[model samples]
Target chain A: MRLLYQILWKDHSRVHLLGAFLGTLAGFVLLLAGIQFYMDLKAVLSENRDLLDPEYIVINKKVNIGNTLGLTGGGFSEEEIAEIKAQPFADQVAAFNSNKFPVQAYTEGEQVPNFITDLFFEAIPDEFIDVKSEDWKWDPEKGTIPVIIPQDYLNLYNFGFAPSQGLPQIPKGVLSMINFKLRLQGQGRGNYDDYNGRIVGFSNRVSSILVPLDFLEWANEKYGYFEKNDPSQIILVSKDPTDPSIIRFLEERNYDTIREKLKSSRMNIILKFVLSFLVLVAAIIIGLAFLVFLLSLQLMISRSSEKIRRLNKLGFHYREISRPYILLLFLLMAGITGLSLLLTSILAGQLHQTAEAWSLDISSSLHGVIYGTALGLILLITASNVAAILISTKKLCK
Target chain B: MLEQDTSGSEVWEAESLLLEQGKPYVVEAPSGRGKTSLLSVIYGIRTDYQGLVYLDDRDLSSFSSKEWSKIRKNKLSFIFQGLELFDELTAMENIQLKNRITAYHSDERIMEMARLLGIDPFLQRKAGILSFGQQQRVAIIRALCQPFNFLLADECFSHMDRENSLTAYKLIREECEAREAGLILTSLNETGLPNIDHSLKL
Candidate 1:
């Protein structure tokens, strides 16, 4: 067997085999690294989402000139709301209900400055509200309306408004303690009623000033005079915010939302595209490398054609003659698999370190799918090459 | 039985000719008379003939490649006219390449046969650099390194001098007698060697 190897292996071109080895290794590293990073990024994207509650997306039509001039309504019609309700991503949908009458608020408290301001109110289903409080209900007998204001409005007043105005910063507890009166007015003169209003909670989900649904319904019935208009805002609950179709649908319909909320979904689409392209290029390289490997072995066998026939004449089977070639192929394939995996893991470790600087959690090791892919591809290449070696060597034998 | 005309031949034209074991037969024919072809057909290398050939009552063409491989390893041996030696291998390695398959001969026995054929000093050299006579002696030793019921020597001694040819023939005869195996030696002309009892002419 050693003599057979010595005689047969002498015909192989060293440069050809080395080129094949390096080419295959490069392809394997590319493929494995693509898979590794894709998995890690997907994990990181979902991990960030898990820190927040289920996604609530608020969508509104893009305000164009036509909407500003009243040529087209700046609101969602019944058909549009129904269509949004029918979407697969919208697990729950609600349209904002606004007060159909004018309202003005005045603070009459010693601890707070005297001020009067016009206010608008919107209402949605209580289930969609992020703040859960006992005071969020409507009681006509109590004559107190519970209002939920956006967290951003308060932050703006404290961080942007009050500091520049030389006004003292008010804490949330102090602000909620102030008493205010809301005067609801009817269409006719001297037809108005004043009721007490209290701030119940701050909402991170909805950007509008919200009141209870029942309270708004009662007030609109009492003081309603303006014509009805379609709701301008639609809030929907989604279980999986990383569905890229949400962004595509919004863009196609000319709808607008907070872009930061769907960052993961947008990142997902881009990641998939980049990874697929990487895999395609790697496949081409691996394919060409595989062809080179097959041809190189076949050429070596043909160069040793006379020697093989001589060995066969001496009672060495063609299978025996193929042993050296198969052994060489096995060694090269194993090396590619091992070295590619090692290189991909090293790249992953470097990526993990870089992501750590950004406080992004990325895995430092190769994913399990990377090994499955490498092993599966290596076996496929080795099996086909071994078959080719057997076939060509048999052709040379008696 | 071959594709050529066989009207004047003895073995090809005969109705029935049985060559027995433990006997030596010399097939004498001029060039282009199928001397090598006859040996090749019997060795199962050439299949262009029309008639049936049998080995121990089993049809020769009925054997698969695996069966032929086994027969070549353990049952039949041929010293091809082309000498079929690996030129890159040392003469001893070439011999051991065949001997390792069956382990039929010890290293000392191979060396003894090499010395008898006057090729002992050239055993360690690559067969490609040796003289044709030396390479022929190497092929002879390689052929004898296996166990076979019949030894087919296809003009193997054509390159050797008369003295070396006699010495090699003596060594072959001794090996054949020890195993009680038959010998079919093809030659272009008559060899006046003494012990061959049968000679067939083409």
Candidate 2:
């Protein structure tokens, strides 16, 4: 209405403009920041998938002062394994089997000169091994043994050990081609055996050299020196790693976990928790900002209450009296949202450059869905508040 | 007609005083005799009184605030004793504000009313800075800017001289006649209105 326009134009004040602009800007920032945090957290979680399996985790007994001084050893007892298996989250648990005899390995080939070194081997259940290479299976009757090595071991050799020793770094394809010869010595207590050892595959899940369970048992039996011993490390398959109870149980027992696979997953879990907490805080701030806007509206209306009363006495309906206020607030929110989106877009450009530098796969852009959600939520909350304030003002017209 | 009390006892009364459209009535009273209270009751601004007031045989007390607003918008206009105009607005703005409510008057008609009221020269002056008599003329013109079936004036001419009061009353009477509206006025002395069809004393 022309009357509504005249009233608004005549009553414009700096106080009103400042109050509305600041409240709207604060609310816009909170919403945009919260949404950006959530998106970034989602990207981090997705990137962690290549680092760790969600269902598989490796743990060992915590190393204490007694363990270092040889007063105790860092190994899992039978009762401890039984207790772990009884846990509700634990779907399956297996221990790493270590050879109990002295062993040495060497390679003699054209590309790889003869080099001899002491070696240790470990074995786990075939079902727990993620690498599906057919050659990984070993039989005592076979002439050669198949082994799986950690992928990072080659990296350490190529970057750290080989360079220091002035030797050529062994590429994965060439390493798999050469057969490693192993000699088991029993020191006159039992007969020694010589076997050909070949690398079958590399596993990201396990960080040690892996042999077949059958092979480790046969070799330990043939070169028996002492009684069988308990395992020092364990691999557990859980239904859900993100369950808080699982972490609590591990911490309560003072167990140490392999950080390689769990490093990124653990970070993801923590980041998700932080994301939720930040969103709740942002919601509270937004709620306060909305109250500020409503209070500003109340102050403006109170300043003009006398004119409003007179208008009402002249038989102008309540809607006519409140139209200008609702219109002004709607316009303010629209403007603030537009400015926030512009700023977010600019910030997203910078985020893309940072992501590229970090070698992250995340695309730095504001998703339309998130923008649409933020706009819808802001307008919905503000409109409801405006309607409530107007209704209360109308009630006071008497 | 209805009579009621501001204190414990009735101050004035009349028997079956009927106000019809296109008629004029004058109520005479001494000072502090509830003349303004009587006009306020008729205008639906005062309800804390005893006695029944009716319009078309419907009890006035039964009307809701919303219904009273409708009556004020389409059927009734009032000029209070204080000439209750927005003090911050100019004289012309005061008239234009009322016209905006009903849109019943054109610019030429408003100008003609201002000329008749002798307030055309002061139309641009703020009401609060002007003399009480000038504001009273402005309020009178504002009252006529809306469509009405009745016009109630509660000693609206107290600050004006007799000449200006007569001129303001002439414009009011002409506007009321053109719209077939009844005029109910109270005065401490004679209003000098012609053809007084009804009379009351309080």
Candidate 3:
């Protein structure tokens, strides 16, 4: 006990105390950012709603970072889809067709020029119907279906229900959608009529409208490059890591697969490229935060570790050394995290109030702090540091 | 084992022979003839060198790590080489901390240790606020609280005057006698640890 204190105090008091505190600040924020980044992206791209979340299927190759969708082609061939469904890890497979809705409208007579591409929608597997968010329930009686949009769009227009006159009114029958929107347009504006089926539900909020793939396929035939075309779609793999997606199993471990299959070769590169790119960007951001965290951990270990060792040498148990430092770190990190959240809240509030569009609900949320935004400053200042301190403290003890 | 090398294989290796249970051994050596190393081994920190260290007639090597740690806590004590003392704690708190770790019944051992070393005067001051000499004494008092078969002092009295040295030496000897504990102290000069029960010089 005495020995641990001696060492901790020596380093803490003389040189590294301030550094430790600041490091905690850094660590907390970075870790928070990693989670937030994942979440923010997840909040955007995540599929599924009230049932199985729709999985995304990409090529079985290493996707490059910063690049998405190299080539467009035929959807997964029947054989490939069959193989995917056959795997133990497979949930279910369903073919889908998607097209951009660049222009959208509430009234049939006019269109909102800048409303831009609503995310491509698909006919999801029955399993994925409820797992994503708030599933859209089809109303066969009224022949009316729910429309889902990215929550970003809702936030943009004030929860999609703001009474202001300048923005077009959102149609009432739309279901919920996710909060983010991805723009994949190369040219020509698409309108809401692009979908074939009526929207009956939402995975989240209305960022984009989702309906069965039949609707989008019809629209693509009506508009996309090929004539009489039933557009091919990217295979969506919905397997959780703990429960590997069928595609993940087949993709990993140099397995026996359809060698050089046409669909696999082209779409393989494209899908793998897109998903991997997204995952990679997410990973790099997190990895950078982790690296900084690790370095800070090394510093922390160098500082307090010797002291802990000395304490252990003096017949002190692990708990004796660990308890005090843990308590100290908890207190310090709590303060930092609290202060950061507070600061972020204030900033988000002012941003919402002062900046017009960026203040959308997802950006400015409860107390004007969105999930990621609320924790951003703290994550920036503290999360990584907390991890760094913990890891370093643990390492030092060993 | 301070006569030449620390272990038996060295050219002039001198090993410590145990005195009767309540005696003091003064050891003298150069800055690094394993004085602290020998003390650590006795308390079981460096145990892999060629050694036959036995505690209560049992080889230390045979004990499990947990068992060794338990014996070290209950049966022995150490004054660290760097005079490692908690900077955040008061001098009195430093002594109290030692008692807290060994988990003996709460008593006035802290005050008792303080009074014995005359550290009671600086009891309320943080260790960081104390002078080196005072810290040294507090470190000594901290080591004095453990109920043990041996107290290992690592160059504890190198900076003290003869009178202060004599005071520390007398207190250590008296405490050893009272508890039937042995004293094994290291020094560049045999200023504090004295008398002739067992002597090893390198």
Candidate 4:
């Protein structure tokens, strides 16, 4: 213990302390921040699962030169659908049913009458539809059709179309209160009818306008003049949205998917990659910092080599002389680890505040993964240095 | 047994040596005759030799490092020729260091010994700052601070004057007599001490 006091009171390598503190702090921050980003991203994605279901994906054919020049059909064929169904990743597949008849939609009961515009109506199986409001269903007996539109459409209307047309911007709740009229016509069959269409909800998942399958079937049966038409868009229920195989498969087939959900999935992959890369970099920097620590210790030991030899001549054992060095290293390592954890907590709290400003809920607690990794690094580094000091002191004793 | 130099040249040879308990032996040799090397071998500090050494019945070569440390701490004590003191420590600390381990003498006893050796005035001074004779007396005092069955002195009095040398020898002889320990003193020539029970010239 007296030896320990002497070693601690005398040994001060400022360069080593500065190097270790700054290097390890930087490495630890990068490691913790990367881990924090990954955790927050996962949390946000999980919370928004209703908006972007990992089990569902929007698939379309590649719009290439062959497709534009009419060399190949720009849609899924029966064989193509069968091929998709055979894949292990595709748990279920559903096609968007299109109304073969022409559609004319216009808003009614509004202060400023909206212009009548031609529109396309698509439908999917009720089981595949995410919206669960009572108004989302169709009753052909009542001549009322339920429709779901993209949320982006409302944003465009309120922010772009309404101002340009000198119409008051309408909020979503008020817009849902207003009724609309839809006109269906079969050109060659000379059949026409008007029905009441009501907006049930907005969809962030599916961008295209949606109506009930029952209404689409009845309308097409009564007014559609063409033969059964192939669907251009298909909804695929992938087993795992985060699977690299799914992305690779889509890329290999020269197919495209929904931009928003695909972006989310791609961001997840990129975050994982960045996390691993940052951890690797941190590991390398930590190794260097530990090396600097060891070099400093070696310098101190070599400086005291003469004293050690003298003490050995006086019948001092190696363990007794080297204990002080090992203790100092252990205390230093523990201090750095503790400071890093504190800094991480403070930084994580600031990140949480930033996320809250963006209307995202994120936790500021240290993630178990980051904690475990830091602890492992501290233990590994300290143990290695202790062993090295012991060995060197033994040589000195000899 | 022959003690060889770094070039493997024989420097000193002894056919037989026996040290009886409670007896003093003076080993005399000229300079560069491995006088210090002989003391080092007996103290278990050097093993690079061409012959076997035995402490009683056990061969010195078979002793592990721990065993050697035990012998140094409990049984054998040596005052090196160069007086390998910790320069960073004080003269008082140098004595206290060994005394702390051996606990053979109290602080008052150590101070009394320091006073008799003429080192009590520089007790708090760093060993590096003291004169050669002062440091030699400090080393002598440190060596005597420990309990031992054998005390090896390698020219410990070379830097001291005759009067101081006699005083150191008197104190060492009295301590050895009290402990029933054997004293091995290496010197360039005999001093004709009547108390010496044996003498070996290498």
* Candidate 2 residue-wise lDDT, A1-398, digit = tens: 66545654455566756665766576566667667755765666555554345468888888899989999978999999999989987889998999888888988778666999998888999988878887877666777988889998888999999999998888888888888798887758557778899998888888788998988888787785755678888999975665556776788999888655455456656776886776677677667767767777777777777777776666666676788888777787777788777776677777778877877665577877668866787678667867875785586453
Best by TM-score: 1
Q: What tier of docking accuracy does candidate 4 attain? A: acceptable
Model 4's TM-score against the true structure: 0.79
The parts of candidate 4 lying over 4 Å away from their true place are A3-21, A41-47, A50-55, A64-69, A77-125, A133-204, A207-231, A237-252, A269-281, A349-365, B1-16
Model 3 DockQ class: incorrect
Off by over 4 Å in 1: A51-53, A139-141, A184-193, A217-227, B1-7, B15-17
> Which of candidates 2 and 3 is the stronger one according to lDDT?
2
What level of docking quality does candidate 2 show? acceptable
Q: List ranges where model 3 is wrong by over 4 Å.
A: A1-283, A322-398, B1-23, B26-34, B62-69, B80-82, B86-90, B103-109, B125-133, B161-163, B186-202
Fnat values, one per model, are 0.69, 0.38, 0.28, 0.34
Candidate 4 chain A — worst ten consecutive residues by lDDT sum? Answer: A3-12
Query: Model 4: per-residue lDDT, tens digit, B1-202?
Result: 2223343222343344466668898888779877787888888777788666778778888977677777888878889888988776799888878888788899998899999988899999989999999999999999998888889999988988889999999999999988899898989877765577687776
TM-score of every prediction relative to native: 0.93, 0.80, 0.47, 0.79
Structure candidate 2, residue pairs in collision: B1-B17
Question: Model 1 over residues A112-150: C-alpha lDDT tens digits?
Answer: 779999999999999999999989999999899888999
lDDT of residue B43 for candidate 1: 82
Tens-place lDDT per residue, model 3, B1-202, is: 2222344433235454443456677677878667787787677777556747677877777876556557767788888768778777788677767767666535576666567667778999999899887898888877777787888888887666777777877877777777898887778875634564666575
